[model samples]
Target: MSELERRYHRLLRAYPAEYRRARGAEIVGTYLDLAGPERRWPSPADAADLLRGGLRQRLRAAGAADLIPGVRLAAVLAFFTATALAAVWSVLELHPPRAEWGVPNAGPFVSLGIGVWAAWLLAAVAHAVAPGRWTRRAVALALLSTVAVVPVAALAGLPRPPLFVLLPQVGLGLVALGLPDRLPASVRAAPLIAIAATGLASVNVLPRNDLFLSYYSWTASQILPGAAVVLLLVVLLLGAGLALRADHRGGWALLVLLTPVGLLFLRPLGGAVDGNMRGAPNPGWPVLAATAVVVCLAGPALLPLTIALRKRRRGPGPVASGDRCPTCGRTAERAP
Candidate 1:
């Protein structure tokens, strides 16, 4: 082999063994044909292209090449959002914003609850960085710890756990349940680091407030009707995007992302709206409608449609031979 060919072969090592076996020679031949006689090294563009192609093939082999980018985005959003909310909630519970930063007045149960959430967040980071059976096992254990701590704290007569504290843990558990079993490690690490950085900054720099109570208060009006409508619309659009790109499974995964918002919808809009507003009692119709539409599109409607479309595109089964039926694998009579 020429020097150029030898260098190309080394670069091709980025691809999986099976893929290299199947198409390596064809790819090498194409590259050699494109190169000049004096070429002895890969151009930067060629090296980059080979690396990109190799990563793509690896994702395909893992059965998540299509879903990794979307899932990674969703995971980062979930992690940072959860971490910020948890930190704010813990900070507020420990020291009221208007009051002095007193000693850590939160009881042992509160501390334990906070630790459980922290552990859950770390587990999510671990899974995102090194996804596999063992990382998944760690996530399961972390989820169980969060679940166990919540009930124990409640039973011990600690204050009712706030929504921010509970929502992220629940969402992580859902992600653990729904995420694909295998994913490329290259796709995992970047998002984990981004989430960790944002989480640290949010906890350290952001000021705490009664933000949780403001959102969850039964009598206090927190969000305006127009804002609620916009939020719901954004959720619906995100769900639709996931459905189109990753199909039904991805659509369903958005449910975890929207769970906290969905829970908020259960609260009466009348209490959260102005009394003199036009359709004050009924202005929330849009919110409810949007929620129902999103649920249908992301849940039942998308799954069946995807399945039907795939089946149609796949066509029908092959014809059965005399000894057996292809559809049911049963014995068939011989032709006369």
Candidate 2:
């Protein structure tokens, strides 16, 4: 085989082995013919198209044809939620109360998290207006910055949020990485709108004393932190509802996306209830963590059963004995 044919075959590896065995040569031939003489290396467009087709075929074989659309919806929602939450948290961190405690001013430029969130925001904007390649590059940069900030912040002795809190940002970013190359204008604009609205709310709510010390305190008394939790829950639920209206695939994606959010809050909720953040070791942490794990998994686990039940209901229900069709009020025809 020539070098061009070899490369084409390699790209075909994206498909399942069985599919490759059945159709790989045909696909490679089509591309090879298109390449003509003196052509080496698949064009970017062809590579991307092949990869996408392979992924769809794989999903279809897995009986998950809806997964692509579901994942795309989840990615958009997760990205918006992550960026907005980051903005609120960043602003909340900047509230004046931290200054009295010698916490460094965490402006957009000075703080690791601020920088990370800024990268995410830029990526969101790029997803909205930039080409697919540029959007992907921007998203990759944002994810890298998010992951890198943890070690850097720790090394620098910067005050960081709890591990659970930090994890959702990373989780959401990973989900967001699957966002479709194209999106509706409203979908593209959502993150910016969420950031603007949440940022302003966080700024206005102003953290009460001791708010930062226990960020998950949901008491309306705590204002900023409380609003943050409420805002996150609302966004998550609304997005889940919208996605679920479409299909079970969205339900699965929502479950996947909610796992990190559960982790983000459960530790703090445990601590707040047990007064652990006041310095005592909370014995309830393990129990709370386990419960959270169960809760997160339960939704996804039940989804298949629910889908099965719906299918059963739709199958061959008893028809009225009026000898008429249910639709168009037409008389039913009897088979000989």
Candidate 3:
């Protein structure tokens, strides 16, 4: 094989073993036919295209043909969730019950300077109206801003939210990066309106209390933050249910992507219930961190099993005419 052919083969390694075995020669030949005689290596464009194609094919082979689309859809949902969480969390800093508990009374300039939540909301707006590349840039900036919170808070002597809380927001931002460059205008408008309505409802229904205190205390004390978390969970479940009805892959995508966020929220919520019942304090960050780690580890292991089980439940697709039967190895008969 020529140098170009060798390099192309290396790139094709991104594909599954079975796929390469069946079509590797044909793929390499096609590239070779397009290359000039003097070509010593695959062109940059060709290399990228091959890698992209390989990844897509691999996902299809794994029964996730809709993974990318589902991820894009999930990204939008995640972005909205992350933004709302950030908004609620941001308020905690502005109104700490004690002088030392948070940035207590820190003016909008200092408290909202970093504006992690606003960054995500702006990204959503960009995604709604901007070009694809610009939308990606906006999302990337929002993600970087979220990561910057820790160091920024440390340096400024500010008390940020717990690590468990921030970690999942980061995860959501990362997933939101999968959002398509250009979504329909309606898609963009709906999330913003939903967020607005959430804000209004929160303002009207919940009394004026220190959000931070409410979030950390027992169930009865945590009414406001708890309600917010529950509402967000309900929105996510509704999205997943609607997606599942339309396309199974979309529902699964939402579930998988939101798993970390759900784990984070559930721990605190569970701790609150237990704390209330036992007259104990809510679990600390350490316990929550442990739960996040375990979920991260178990997620990969459980996904394939879940997919396999789903496939088993679905059984096999209808055999087309001339397709060999799994049991008898006889071609299927045509419909009358």
Per-candidate TM equals 0.44, 0.66, 0.72
Per-residue alpha-carbon lDDT of model 3 for 1-336, expressed as tens digits? Answer: 677888899999998787798789999999999999999989999999888888666555545555555566666677666666655554444444545655343343334323776776687577667847777788788778778877887787755544555667766777677666666788777656756665666565544554433434342234333533654565467667755544444455645564645554646654665576675666655555666676667654566676566556655543234432222223356566
- lDDT of model number 1: 0.51
**Off by more than 4 A, model 1:** 1-105, 108-112, 163-168, 180-187, 190-192, 200-205, 208-336
> How many residue pairs collide in each prediction?
0, 0, 0
For model 1, residues 75-157, the per-residue Cα lDDT tens digits are 54454344334444344334222224332223532245556656655665766766666655666776677667668756665
Worst 10 residues of 2 by lDDT: 320-329
Give candidate 2's TM-score: 0.66
lDDT of 2 by residue, 180-286 (tens): 77767887787778888978877667555344523334422233234337545655676567555443455545555555555445555555655643554452656
Question: Which number leads on TM-score?
Answer: 3
Name the candidate, 2 or 3, with the larger TM-score value.
Answer: 3
The TM-score of predicted model 3 comes to 0.72
Q: What value does the lDDT take at residue 3 in candidate 2? A: 92
Pairs with steric clashes in candidate 3: none
